[model samples]
Target: MQDLELQAVESALTDLVDGERRWATTTLEQRRDLLTRMRELTGAHAQEWVDTAVQIKGLDPNSPLVGEEWMSGPYVMAASLGVLADTLDHLAKGRSPLADVKFHDVRDRVAVNVLPTSVYDELLLSGFSAEVWLRRGVSRAAAKAEAGLAQLDPSRTAGIGVVLGAGNIMSIAPLDVLYELIAHNRVVVLKLNPITDPLLPVFSKVLAPLIEVGAVRIVTGGAEVGGALVQHDLVNHVHMTGSARTHDAIVWGVGDEAVERKRAGDPKLTKPVTSELGGVSPTIVIPGRWSNADLKFQAQHVATQRLHNGGYNCVASQALIISSDWDQKDRFLAEVRNAIAAAPERAAYYPGSDDRVASALESYPNAERLGPGGGRLLVDDVRPDSAEPILSGEYFSPVYGVVEIPGTGASFTAAAARTANEVFAGTLGVNIIAAPASVKELGAAFDDLVEDLHYGTIAINAWTGVGYLTPTASWGAYPGHTIDDVQSGIGVVHNAWLMDGIERTVVRGPFRPAPRSVIRGELALSPKPPWFVNNKTAATTGKRLTEFAADPRASRLPGIFASALRG
Candidate 1:
């Protein structure tokens, strides 16, 4: 607790609160203008932002990973700002953001189609469909009533929001700030994670409009600075995107005493704290008739899920739930391993990633090592009765485990869903991959399985990471989790539709999307996504994609495609 750092944090918080008070009374028109300014600023600084992250991550400057950095950085923030501006613009015109809401009746609550709000969305993300399913007893009408009300009348909300930014994703902090500004109508003071301090200068320049107006403040420091800001009297609320362990430390005290404090229900801070935490996400594979092509396609899908962030993602498929009785199960598993081994290795850039991977392998010495490096170890052959560390812990590394169920078809899907809900720890995101024929056969039972799963986002034949990227979808753990027993932390973010009472987001994609479609596939998918570790030109394609997203031009398509083809 250095007095110098503490004093700086206090001064920042004091100024932030004053600005937020003024912001609380700001008109919808003013908010709209601010967000528009932010969007344009973000677009202008998009390239440098991506470059900074890629350089820090030790990635090749011109690699496809540039796309990864861009998409998860300025691209996401820019998209969020654009959506928020549109929502605010609607409010200024006295139109509800929910007036465009479309709903489909699932087994329990209705699934609200929030994205593809226009033809532009169809162009940007083709076949990548997203929907938010409200908790049971929450109706579409009720949800619409709550949508964008704060944006319409922000006089009711005023405060200084402290955002503990995530180091893993560059877009996370900016998006968190945007949520505070647009959704909650709070002025924000964002403290960048130590790992992301390098981006502070870029953020400062990009967010200059908001900072100049005192609506947003960007700071860089470690936990000491965060602690001071969190405890500051001027801070009205807190939002974090990190681990549950970090959350516990912030909510309670640190060290052994913190565990006891949590047990005793003693919290250090009682302010309204919302978070987007990590998870040991599971992918349930429903067994059915399958061809060699299906096996190859699904294998690539699961491999991409695990290797997306070098398996550093909270929504990475930590556990694979498959039916042992299926004839193609072994072949599918083999294909998954092959896909992982085929991809080029990414540097284990995140701190403690190597230690985490090593520890998991130590726990299961017999785990099969995949790929060139000793980083990715598959836990397919582990005894089910043993203490499986892979299922129990969220390994923030390129490690994956496979759990086998005895049944097939509907029974297999049901068992997998139950296991994912009860066995795996975190309730953040879960994946279900099933053949179309199998899904149709399950019928009502499939709906029931979706209703029963206790996860925030469930992707059918898709990764929940896609759901997290979808601005309309809510990204958080399933509801009904307590602070002491927070599995994947509390609350949600990136929800542009302003839909209320959201329990989960279900993003459905084809098992094998046609090439060149929004969803990636083997054939015609024009640009190889940078997230695929094997993609050679990730940086170049990623940059082009970011530029196109910021300002679309058909002329840029051919070059982007050519770069991807080279990869």
Candidate 2:
């Protein structure tokens, strides 16, 4: 490394040494106030943040799709700050963050309800709900006792940590930094991915409070800078949000030596590391009797699952699992194709997106190219037992393949879960879309089906991306992976509740939207969610929602609801 680069890294770490100690000894009230100030600044700069992301992604500033930037960039970060502040507030009051949360016993485990903790959630999110299922053997009392910063030793001086940021989403890098500071009690030097370095100034301004205190440092560069930061003696831990290949390169070195080190169970970096490496996530469709409207809406939902952000997301649905015996299988597939064809066009702005799309085309020469310019590709009837790369590899682009499993109901559900757990590459997340009536008919069998899945976050009739946006839900791969075979990296993030012993999060949303949901006996009032690619009022709703999250007042509800209803 150049002397200048090395000096810069050393200076960044040197500045954080004292800050880390100060942060460790800070009272809960002080931490809460810091977060509150951060939230206010986030609102102040929310527009600039979204605009920078939009310009970076080559998005039209006036288009509704710019709302994607608004929600994913500022809205998520603001919500996370507010949620963390609320958690600190509870801790300052000498209470568990989960004091008002409900817990239920599911077989031998306890599931803590992490959503709908406020009237705002009930009104804004309506039927959406999430629960963090504690690891087996954790009693409800143990969950409460283990919540929040109280678990940390007061005397131990926390050290500086390094966070290798993700490139795709604008909020990921900042959110990871917040988690390291608040959840793990460490001051962070966040190295931004080169692709997203353009937002450095915006992030710097929004995080000025922490930057002034030396509790946070944001840098930008390629791997060399990240390497120097991680290798610095002052850095005690590492957290990254990127691909498994990068994680392996960091932990086990590279080239022939890295392979040999893995075989011998030796790592180059001795410091503790945690990650959220993405895998080929699957969306399982349970067979059910359905009307045409049901099929079309779900088709759009599945399309959004794959095509959101042009399929550049870590949790985007890459594998479509369906029951072969369903009579509407062919019809639903046709509708999905139509939805993909009809969706708005956007640039595949992520680095190497074109090459990834080309590779998928080479792998499946007959893959249908839907939509204008033929950017969206779909491969149908992928054999379960075949040596297909799509089954075990993550194609981080606008490409998805369908796999059919035999049987229906419980048997089909079990086989689908087995295929996802055993066949898919990563355990980050999975989505199951079953009709409300079908789930009701399955009863305990459905709950057992969810319990059987091995992914960190499971969404029933909802997208796992929703789980990521929900600040209270724990986000990561299911525990038990070792460093040598780290599939989805390690540990969790966005867990504002701070409850320990989390195995996975289960999120559920209404099967249908608004009046249709009400007509079908479901009372959820949520319209087409603002995150949907097709939502016409998303930009307005997302901006309003971000402002509301920063200062949640009842006066803001009518505007948010009006904009959302128009979507």
Candidate 3:
């Protein structure tokens, strides 16, 4: 490494040495105060953060689609600050964060209701609910007993951690830093991805409280800096949000020797590492009778799943799974095509996006380029057993394919689940869309299907991204993956409840939007969610929601409701 780069890394480490000790013994009240200040600063700079991201991605500032940046960037950060502060408040009082939360038995496993914890959540995110399912053999009492940092031995001194930030979403790095500092009681040195290094000013300002206290440090560079930081003697733990290839390079040295070392179960870096590498996630659609409106609305929903962030998201739906026997399959497919074509156009800003899209086109000659500038590609009617790369690879672009299973009802759902598990690349998340009536018809079979799928986060009648946005829900790949095959990574973050032994998070939303939802007997009051790409008022709603998340009040409800209803 160059002298200056090496000095920078050394300085960061040296600064954090004392921080690691100071933070480990810091009182919970002090930590909560830092979070409160962080939240205030984040809200103050939220607009600037969103505007910077908008310019970086070449998005129109006037377009509603700027809401994507608002929601994914500052909104999530602000919400997470509040949630983590609440957890610390409970810990300061010597109580479990999940003390009053409801727990229920699902197939003999304990599932804790983590959402709607406050009246604000019920109003702001009505019709949405989330539950964190404990890993098998974890009883409810054990869950409460092990929740938060208080459970650790008081004299145990926390060490410094190195966090590798993600490029796609601006909030990911800061959120990971928060998790490391509060949840694990570790000081963090967060290295921003080169692609998002421009946001260093915004991050520094927003995270000033932590930085001033030496509890966190933000640095920028490519692999060389990250490599040096992770392997540094002072760093005791490592967390990253990126690809599996990158993770392997850091854990096992790169090249032929790296391959052999992985094979031999030996690693270059001996410190504990946790990551959130993405995979080729699937969107499974159950067969159901639907009105024309249902077909149109759901088509847009699926389109949003694939096209959000121009399909650069780690959890972006890459495979569309449907039952061949559904009579409306043709209509639904047509609607999806229309939705993809009609969605707003945006730049494919991520590195190598064009090449990934081109690779998909080369692999499937019949792929359709739907959006303007030919950036969106969709391959329909893909066979489950086909050797196509799009079916199993995480393209991380505006490219997706459809696979059809031969059955209906519970049999098709079961087969689809099996195919997703067997054929897909990673276990990060999966989305299942079923009408309320269709789910009712399946009865306990629906619950059984959910329990059987081995994904970190499962969404029924909603996008898994919702699970990511919910600060309390655990987000990561299903556990049991070893470093040799670290598919979609090995650990979870953003779990504000601070509960351990988490298997996965299950999130459910209304099958239909607002008025239509009520008419269809879903009884949900939520309108078209602001996160949807097609929501016209998303930018406004997202901004208002961020403000509310920072400083929640009854007075802010009217404006939020008004903007959301318009969307």
- Expressed as tens digits, the lDDT of each residue in 331-409 for candidate 3 is 9999999999999988889999999888888888888889798778889858886355876678999997999888998
lDDT of 2 by residue, 500-527 (tens): 8999999999989897899999979999
lDDT value, candidate 3, whole model: 0.89
TM-scores for candidates 1 onward, in order: 0.94, 0.98, 0.98
CA displacement after TM-score superposition, residue 327 of candidate 3 (Å): 0.4
Which stretches of model 1 miss by more than 4 angstroms? Answer: 1-4, 382-387, 515-531, 535-540, 552-567
Per-residue lDDT tens digits for candidate 1, residues 1-567, read 677766768777777777877777678888788878877777789878887888778887765556678767777777777777778887778877777768888776777886666665664455567888887898777777678845757787757889999988888888888888778878899999989899988899878878877788877778889988888788889999888888888998888888788778788888888887888888889888877877876788889888876777878888788888989999999999998887666788999998998898788888888888666888886433325677776888888888888897667767877788778878999999987778889897887788788899999877887787777788888988777877798888888866678888888766654552333332223233445556677667666766766665788777766776676
> What are the candidates' C-alpha RMSDs?
2.7, 1.3, 1.3
Name the weakest run of 10 consecutive residues (lDDT summed) in model 1.
Answer: 518-527
